[model samples]
Target: MIHRRSGSVGAGAVDGGAGWDGVEPQDYDDPSLGGVRKHELIGEAEGARQYRMRYFEVPPGGRTARERHPHDHGVMIVSGRARVTLGSETHEVGEGDVVYVAGDELHCFEALGDEPLGFVCVVGPRSAS
Candidate 1:
């Protein structure tokens, strides 16, 4: 089954290309992830109660921080090519490639092509307690 969200932003918007109106690309909070920017597509502001969707862009020769989290992640490559490291295994991914990161698994994404590597990721809300 296909799931879709509609509103002022997200997949419902009529904007062309990978970007949406009102969404601004921001630098990755972690400095270790070089030349990475993030655009939040869906989250608490969108009234989503379960998950948040985000788009990440890594410039050529850049990579995401190598870290592990307790929350699982669903990632899909939307543009360019990347070298994704899941645990100890690293694999090359291109457009339309899907990646599943299990809870507490070590993972990172590196842009391998001249253009920016863009990908969308869905993640569950973090527990407050």
Candidate 2:
């Protein structure tokens, strides 16, 4: 389950380090899976009622776990290159490229360049259960 924190001040000016002030980067790996660090840009604490924005960095030779969720995702490459697997197809993506992963579609991302693969992902709100 995901946890929500209160008191976020929203975005910062500098995009260097692929991070912003007030936001902390955390491991995106699950005990059952591994690879990737993530920073939450906007969420419930930031007054977002419908969506959340996050940034992910996958180091070279690293990859996110192959998994599927019931939510859709809007992903945009921010830096470096990556190979994104969506469903049965895999494609190369670079900075400025955008990808859409529909709900329940299996997907994963692997860093392909010497540098880390950085990307922004926007996800729809989760139901309160």
Model 1 Cα lDDT, one tens digit per residue, 4-97: 4322322212222345666666779897675677778887767787988898877778898888888899999877789999999999999899
Q: Each candidate: what lDDT?
A: 0.76, 0.76
How far out, in Å, is residue 36 in model 1? Answer: 0.7
Q: Give the per-residue lDDT of model 2 (tens digit) for 10-91.
A: 1211123455667787778564434567888888768888998998877677788888999999999877788999999999
Tell me model 1's lDDT, rounded to 2 decimals: 0.76
Q: Count of backbone clashes for each model? A: 0, 0
Candidate 1 residue runs with Cα over 4 Å from true position: 1-18
Q: CA lDDT of 41 in candidate 1?
A: 82
